[model samples]
Target: MSFSSIAAAARPRYGLSCALAALCLSYSLHANANTPPKIGGAPVTSVTAAHYYSFQPWASDTDGDKLTFSVSNKPLWASFDSSTGRLSGTPIPPANVGTFTNIVISVSDGTYRASLSAFSVTVRSLVNSPPLISGTPATTAAVSQPYSFQPAATDPNGLRIVFGISNKPAWLSFDSTTGRLYGTPGATNAGAYPNILISAYDGYFKATLPSFAISVTVTQASNGT
Candidate 1:
């Protein structure tokens, strides 16, 4: 074979190799431009159900690509909204009192992925540690009688109080923050009350236990023949 012919044949092989190398380089560069998968998840800063809370993730691609999400380890009594980035649910209480639960949420943005978010959610039960109720005496006449009650709750989280009462009358008044109970007895409130439950809410959407009920007996005045 002539020297020139040998060189010509080698040129095609060299060019093919160069093209393959370029393709490989392009792929490597494309992959490197993208950000590495990161594990990131923020706990619901506020109440998830009553209010709206979200789970956020930080990821990026070199080409400024869009992001998608996937949850690997979802928590109980909780849900995530990827489009709106909302993670919400009604808190469920554990069997034990004042118990806390840890939620795991997995976040992925299509190309990038992360797992086992450390700070996802802290579920708490609103029971046992409810507020207290006072003012109503053990015995009171039902006829022409009015009684009032307020939320008397104590929680470690310093939760805000919301007032609610049963067997309420127009003259009855209640305060959530303060455990003040004031009300005049109506004529109908002469019977015995089995229990008066008051509910106090906490930061974790937990209701106070016992509902702060009070037993009462009514004695009517001597008007019988």
Candidate 2:
């Protein structure tokens, strides 16, 4: 072959080799590209002092890589679980009862990382308050009739309230969580139940309502003249 012809042939071969090399390089880069780890969850913003609190974030890596968890500006009383991404502990009064701000939680998969939005936690001291019991119970019920009474109760401190009765009747049933007293009064259950005092209790205090009575009697129609 002539010199110019040989040169032109070599030029096409070189160009083809360069194109194949570039295609291989692009495929290698795309196959090895790393997708970042993803982390997210809603963290508790407010907690009562002397009460247990916990927050756990969900984390995952699309590339199926092992993840490592990290936290920044963590509270002194709280502890972190790097493997599970759990933040938990009890805050004490007078010391940890304040706002902890700009807390960051992140997860890394060696090549890339992701993080949840920065958050803050406010710890407030526990202030106890007595629960209030309201509503009236019926004083009389007829035989073979359904009788129901539920005392409305609430706590000022937003704590849970449990109910109790000092002199509950044998024919009635009481629910502690909702303060409901209910039952059907049969003919044999017709009688006078007295001195029934309903009480509400929070974790730190208790409140009681005035004592009441329930009287079950046979209907006048049943004892027709």
Candidate 3:
């Protein structure tokens, strides 16, 4: 073949090879563009109520696209930041103190999105301790005579204490803050009073002491003879 004719034949082959290479490249790019982002393993977390809580999820897109995050079925007291892929907020009392399940989080690369479901999170609350009776009170009193007694108690959390009595006699009175039981019995009060129940309470929890027996004796009037 002549040199010009050989060059002309080679031109078509070279152009065809370039076109085939471009077609393959275009297909590879399109496939990569359609690939979805991947989310890393979801973790179980425990948080405390009235305290700050935060967690970050890992994710990536094969096409090097920027990924945004979001969460669904999250606790009402908490929030998620899509820009940072962080779930964070301060949990409230009562409502937020419990085990929560099936939280879903999604990551998106504009066109495609991926999700993780059934995540577990727990919020623990501070427990209030009940008060305890330290010792028994005096169980006897004289009619028409002066009487004084105080019930002792302690609280595990060092909370302020209040005292109360149930089924108390008409002559008896109680001091809630000092826990003092003081009353002067009248002549009609001489009897077996078996219905008195003493209780102590902190702000949040309460404790009651067992019932006790109290015997009142009749007092004789003294006169100069």
Task: Give TM-scores for every candidate, taking all chains together and pairing residue i with residue i.
Answer: 0.40, 0.64, 0.45
The TM-score that candidate 2 achieves is: 0.64
State which candidate has the highest lDDT.
2
lDDT of 2 by residue, 1-225 (tens): 899999998998999999999999999999999999889899999999867889999998888999999999999999999998899998877788999999999999988879889999999988766888899889998877788989888887776788988889888899988889999887888889999988999766789889999988998754563
Residue-by-residue lDDT tens digits, candidate 1, 55-145: 5655444445555555544555557765533456555344322323444444455566555444534444443344343343433434434
Q: Give, for candidate 3, the lowest lDDT window spanning 10 residues.
A: 216-225
Question: Which candidate's TM-score is highest?
Answer: 2
Pick the winner on TM-score between candidates 1 and 3.
Answer: 3
Better TM-score candidate (2, 3): 2
Number of clashes found in candidate 3: 0
Top-down TM-score ranking: 2, 3, 1
In order, the Cα lDDT scores of the candidates are: 0.51, 0.89, 0.80
| Candidate number with the higher lDDT (1 or 2) | 2
Error (Å) of candidate 1 at residue 75 is 2.3
